[model samples]
Target chain A: SQQGEEDPQALSIQEGENATMNCSYKTSINNLQWYRQNSGRGLVHLILIRSNEREKHSGRLRVTLDTSKKSSSLLITASRAADTASYFCATEGPTDSWGKLQFGAGTQVVVTP
Target chain B: DVKVTQSSRYLVKRTGEKVFLECVQDMDHENMFWYRQDPGLGLRLIYFSYDVKMKEKGDIPEGYSVSREKKERFSLILESASTNQTSMYLCASSLWAGRPNEQFFGPGTRLTVL
Candidate 1:
């Protein structure tokens, strides 16, 4: 079963605009991670926010985790055409071992130049 | 940088044929994983190994099997390929899996079963 579910099946935006995506999970998690995948390519890890952390920033990417609501949000600032890709949210539940993650369906983001 | 490479970027096989997908990690990670991606289904874990000669089943492991002979190499096998098995297969590796860690993934193999 999928532990995480990302909102907005798809998004389209112009360059320089910010892109925000939301993800909600069912169970308690140790950490939540975000990944990016280009067309026909494997996924790349973007950032991970622990359950204790409420917000994290990496370059133009910002992640916010609301454990109370079992949800997380990823925000990309000043998006570029290169940022066009599918974004996925994965959760590492406390009951899961060996860092196993359950991924969501993902959100497709299109940044038009 | 951690590098994960799959044996093939694409493969085509007939139904009932045995298929092997190989993955190698240069980072000497202790954990390796196999997943299949399909349209609207996202990536689903098929199997994962934390050490050599050890394996664990994921949510969807009925149609797939995995072998990890060495710490850096993992192989995913399809006993009898079916048309419905055609999808994108991905391999990944990570270190110190006691907690959540970033996974490094191969380019992925697009397999087609006829």
Candidate 2:
């Protein structure tokens, strides 16, 4: 079974609009990481937030985590066509010593021109 | 930057035929993983290795086997291919997974079983 699940399986928006996706997990995690995948390609690491951290920012991307709710959200500011891709959230559980990330179903974001 | 490479970008195989997929990582990372990605199922872990000659079964390990004879190379084997096995295969490697351990991924292999 997957450890994390992403909501809003699909989203569409015009360029320059902000897009937000949410992820919920079931277990206690050491950290949470986000990844992006262009069509027909491998995934790229985006941002990682530790359990102790509540929020993190990288360039135009913002990620927030709420341990109390066991959820995390990714916000893409000033979205562009290039930002259109499948976004996934992965969790590293407390017992995952090998860094085997359990991934969510993913959210597909479409930034239209 | 860490570099992870897959043997083939696209491959076609027939049912009941043996198939082999190879992955190599140049960063000398200690851990490697193989996953299959599908439309609705997302990425499911098939197998992983923490060191040479050591392997572990992942979430969906049925009908699949893995080998890691060398530190830099890991191979995934499908004893006999089946149509349902067709999907995008991805390989990843990371330096001991923990704080700040980001896994580097290979481009991926699209395998079609007829």
Candidate 3:
């Protein structure tokens, strides 16, 4: 079974709009990371937020973490057509176990020009 | 830039045939992972290695086995391919464990079992 699950399986929005995706997890985590994947390609790491940190920002991307709720949200501000991709959230277990990331199903975002 | 390379971009095999998917990372990372992606099931881990000759089973490792005889390369093996095993396979590598250990991924290999 997957430990992380994302809401809003698919989303469509216009350019310059803000797109938000939410992820919920089942267990305690040391940190959560977001990744973007283009069609038929591998994923690219975006941002990572630790359990001790409530929020983080990277360029126009904002990520908020609420460990108490076992959830996190990714906000892409000033979205662009290039941002149209599948976004996934992955959780790193507390023990820093090697390569043990429980990933969410992912949110597919389609940005219209 | 970190480069994780998979040997094939696409593969097709018959049921009961043996299949091997190869992945190599140039970053000299210590950890490597293999995952399968399906339409609605997302990515599920099959196996991972922390170092040469060291392997661990992930969430879905029933039909898969792995070999890491070298530090930079990892191989995923399907003893006997099954129809249910058809999916996109991804290979990734990271420096170590923790939040800061961002994984670099290869383009992936889409495998089909006939």
Candidate 4:
């Protein structure tokens, strides 16, 4: 079963604009991670934020996690045409098994030039 | 560099035929997983293996079985393919055992059952 649900199934924006996507999960999680997948390709790890952390940043990407609400948001600044892809939010549930990750439905972002 | 490779990028198989999807990871990770992605369902786990010859059922394991004969290779098998099984299949691997473990994914195999 999927623990997370991402909002805004699709988003389109011009290059150089900012893109933001949100995700909500049903149960408590140990950590939340973001991933990006190009068309017909494998997913690439973007960033990971632990439950104790509220905000994290890497380059143009920013991730914020709110444990109280069981939600997380990913923000991409200065989007480019190359940034067009599907973004997924995966959560590690509170279980002994560490490698198990439940992913959301994903948000597809199209960056037009 | 960590690399995960799938046997095929696209495959077409007839209904009721047996199908095999192979995945190999070069990073020697101890954990491997198989997932199927559909339009609205996102990604659903099919099976996973934590060690050689050790397999565990995932959320959607009814139509799929897995084999992990070696540490680097994990294979997903469809006993009898069906039209409803057409979807994108993904393989992933991770080094650790618990939460926050980052996974490396392979280029998915798009399967079509006709």
- Candidate with the greatest lDDT versus the true structure: 1
What does the lDDT come to for candidate 3? 0.93
All candidates' lDDT scores?
0.95, 0.94, 0.93, 0.94
Q: Give a tens-digit lDDT track for model 1, residues B42-81.
A: 8899999999999999989998899998889999999999
Answer with 1 or 3, whichever has the higher lDDT.
1
| lDDT by residue for model 4 (A36-68), tens | 999989999999999999999999999999999
Tell me the tens digit of each residue's lDDT in model 2 across A1-113.
69889988999999999999999999999999999999999999999999999999999999999999999999999999999999999999889868899999899999999
Residue pairs whose backbone atoms clash in candidate 2? none
TM-score between model 3 and native: 0.98
Q: Could you tell me the fnat of model 3?
A: 0.74
For TM-score, the strongest prediction is 1
RMSD of each: 0.6, 0.9, 1.0, 0.9
Q: Please write out the lDDT profile of model 2 over residues B8-32, one tens digit for every residue.
A: 9999999999999999999899999
Indicate whether candidate 1 or candidate 3 has the larger TM-score.
1
Estimate, for each residue in B45-98, the C-alpha lDDT of model 4 and write its tens digit.
Answer: 999999999998989999889999999999999999999999999999999784
DockQ class, candidate 2: medium
**Candidate 2: where are CA atoms >4 Å away?**
B98-100
Question: TM-scores for chain B, in order?
Answer: 0.98, 0.97, 0.97, 0.97
DockQ of 3: 0.75
| Per-candidate iRMSD | 0.8, 1.3, 1.3, 1.2
DockQ of all candidate complexes: 0.81, 0.74, 0.75, 0.81
